[model samples]
Target: MERFTSGAHEFLIPMVFYSLFCLVLTVNVAGAVSIQDDCHERRCNNHEPPVRFPFRLQDQQPPHCGYPHPGFQLSCSENKQTLLKLPRSMKLLVKRIDYDARWINLYDPSRCLWRQLLDLNLSTFPFVDEIEPAASYTLLNCSSQDEALYKGNRVDCLSTSASQIIAFRSDGYAYLDNLLNCSMIGNISAPISPYFFRFRLKWNKPDCGDCEAQGKGCRLKTNSTEDQTECFYIPKHRISVRERLMIAGIVLGSLILAMIFIAVGWRYYSEKKKKEGLLKIEMFLEDYRAFKPSRYSFADVKRITNHFKDKLGQGGYGTVFKGRLSTDILVAVKVLNNFKGNGEEFINEVGSMGRIHHVNVARLVGFCADGYDRALVYEYLPNESLEKFIFAARGKDRSLSWERLHDIALGVAKGIEYLHQGCEQRILHFDIKPHNILLDHNFTPKISDFGLAKLCSKDQSSISMTTARGTMGYIAPEVLSRNFGNVSYKSDVYSFGMLLLEMVGGRKNIDDTVENTSQVYFPEWAYNCLDKGEELGIRIEDEEQTETAKKLTIVGLWCIQWYPVDRPSMKDVVQMLEGDLHVLTMPPNPFASTDPTKMGATIPRKPVNRELPTIPEIE
Candidate 1:
């Protein structure tokens, strides 16, 4: 009976164990089939946002669920939290995605800190391999002092303390911490919310391989980086089944939600951008309306200037073309070089001339400010510039008659005086030279090119200048010397004196040559000639010529005194030019006679024992 009981127990035990193993196998198969079926045909519920490509829940899993790319993976953290792991160092907490807009809103962990997230080499994640050129991320709390460095070069920080959106053409995912120092003290205690430091990411093509290989990341979304296909490298590791399944489900769910959000956000952003563009156009139009410039289209300008066929002259800014606008109406059109980036000059000339009505100043008839092209149209004067007449060979013989010279001098003086007192503000002709003075049909002198003109107040006698303005030889000594008080309107007077000296001598004031061992400055030469009983060589065919030359020389000496106080004002200069010659005095030598042989000569020519009089301050 005992043997029979033992036999039954062994048989029953074996059958029971086998039955339990089969039940467990059946359950496992059913579970795998259910999960696979759910993923294959399940339609995402509208109530819970739809999941897009590159993302899928583990419950409805497919082989290419999270991403087809090897390094891309999405996972659910504690409490079904979604996290996206990119190729490099980028790890984004998935929020919502918009399939239509092809964008995802992500929580930036470094947003609460003083530094930037991208600046911290956040582009290292492998999952961000699909960011687009139009894709941009908004930076928060950026300031003027805060500059962005992409790779090794610094990039312009668009805003300070405002969310800055940057767009790129290709994928920027890559690890850069190995190449750059991205270490920062993070504010881990900062508040976290649904929208805590969220930034949008659009799909972009990868372009910077070297940078990615070198482990450097892009700072901005634009083409600021040298290459765009670069991505950061991340170490691979095995993940557990539970962790992988949970993460995949969360990532898929989050990706679906992100697509919906991105679509709505993109539509709003596009509309806002359109409105901003319109506003900018409106503002530009309003600013342009203040000065009513005769507008000329490109075709009209080409026609007026005979297809820019006739060249007048080329300058630092552009080339001037002579054109016939109408019957008996000729114009000089200056076609500015596109590379000469001086829009302020255009604005200054237009604004100053539009408000001023001076006979001695050139008139602006029209202008063109087309894309990459600028042109200025002025009434063409038959007579060229004053330099052509003054610096000619045997200038006195071919010179303007004494009557015309006198009239031109007076006109120039009047123009200068008007700039000093006629207008509400005092205008200083910083660059007063023969080249800037134009001539009319009647040989009348008219001031042109106010590019270097400085408008100051009458009460403010002096203005601060970092560097000397005007032609080198014509620049006043006071402008270069800090000991000579501050520069004022008298500085222009000094320049004018140099110009007058050139006019009288028919040559430059200072000419250095190996033959002329003795420095023959025109002012000093004239002074010495007058001091010595030599033929003033006053080459004058007519009595008018002799008188005009003598008068101009004497007046030129008086204007170019050593000190500003000694020099006469433009008003006094005009009066002196119009007055009789007998009233003019033999002015003192401007540059004290310095023997080149003397070593370290600092003292002026006077009594060795007596002290020179102190120079007065400029008014």
Candidate 2:
């Protein structure tokens, strides 16, 4: 019994000390909380500074909460804005209040603080501007056209439409003596800041500076005492050494525990994600073994591209870099921006480019899928994209001759043709804009950027699409709306048509900056010129160039027919490009019948199966 009692005493002594320590801490916290709760800080809104002792909300706080003065009392406006109304009812928003600094920041709620300053009387207010000293400014009404008037010193708000109100500094009156048609209105004495955006004011009475300096808060000695303020130690503001040690120990212990939990969770999650990524990569590699394009690691890609030092271009999907494979071979590396985007873009580019081997279609050299990083490598064309050449400023070095442009158009058509028919499964190049058309050193155009490509069987005429794809101007009407027709290979024809028109016009199809308003929509305007037998408005040096422009314009109009079924197939387009310009007739004015009711009137009631025309194939 004695031994048991001794053991109980040993345990009870420590328990008693712990209970006392907890009690003391609780009391200290409760005391601090109670002091704050007695005259709690109030705010008009979340953005405004808290109003407390030395400054209090008029209706919200009691009379004993703040200094006994009109300036110390702030009010919440109807709009929930903290407002400090001056002597003349000029309300200024209370932006911030620093009890320690003994300063209050204010700005005119009306935006023009200078207008208020012109007639401000600060004698009644408890605050005075220590930063901005009082100065005299002469107001002058000057003529609007007076060149001698200092325009920078003019008050735009006070001036009329016909005249400028110049607030000339009194000390600099020598420069304003020669002003034309200027009359001095009056002189006003006011505190002026450099830029009257914010007004800062300091106070002397109910001084809490000493208490704040000593790390204590000041309160009235008694509720009735207006003149006397006594310093009181705020436990939260000035914590004891014992409390600091206790808080530090608790924080340190919590942090160590949290760190251990986080480390374990992160390790488990990382291993799981790593395993899943490896499995995905293995499956991707397995599917591409037969195609056998080189697979590069992220490190290898960085090495090949010189740490992404030389950038070629950027698009919505990724940034392309100029890279070298060897001494002689150069490649363009496209580092995808969102490699985790359902893995659609990366899959589309690789899968679509993997099967094809065409002279006009850009060749994929390799790809990278190391960890989170993904990139596609392609053969680098020295001339960049067709956009640089066609859409460039006039007289630049990248401008191509009409003949070269015609050839490029033909090459692009062939590339699209191969995408529609040449492959085992027809590939649809959804995005076929000038930016996607890359040109080699010899100016041969190649279709690139198949990020939006879709695959369907050769026999399938139309495919189901839930959402619209491709650049805005180049997207087919059918793709945007089913009323035009079902989307199919014909959509590519429409995009190619838009591309063709852009190439011919040396501008986009929907150019708004053209001098003639009628010519703003280039395709519509080009058709009007073609229909009227007028020379295309573009600069044409010779008859041959005019004929080339007409041919491309006519083909573009035909391809962009509102109804997909009304548009020609890629094969027909290829033949049309290779054939004589005179043989091609203007397509049934596609833009003429825009109304839903008149659509069938101009368009064919049914898609007529036109006999395919043959032309000599390009070698």
TM-score of each: 0.47, 0.49
Per-residue error at 487 for model 2, in Å?
Answer: 1.3
lDDT (C-alpha, whole model) for all candidates: 0.60, 0.79
Q: Which candidate number has the best lDDT?
A: 2
Off by over 4 Å in 1: 1-300, 338-345, 395-397, 512-519, 542-544, 594-619
TM-score of 2: 0.49
Candidate 2 stretches greater than 4 Å from native: 1-292, 340-349, 593-619
Candidate 1 global lDDT: 0.60
Q: List the residue pairs that clash in candidate 2.
A: none
Residues 124-198, model 2: lDDT tens digits: 567778776666677788887873456677877788878878777777775645565789876656654524767
Candidate 1, residues 1-619, lDDT tens digits: the string is 3564476466557555655655565565445434322223222343333443345544455644334443234555455556665433445566776544445666756453213334433333332423222233323222223235332222233322443322221234233343233322222111112123565665432333344446543112334343223233433335559656755654564565457457645765776799899997987676457434586767788999999999977766578889987988888888877444556656665566555446787667777767667777877877867888877864456576666767777788888888888877778887788887888787778887665677777777777777776778777666777465467888888888878877777667765532453434556766667667443554468766777877888888888775676789999999999898878887877656544322112233432221223332222
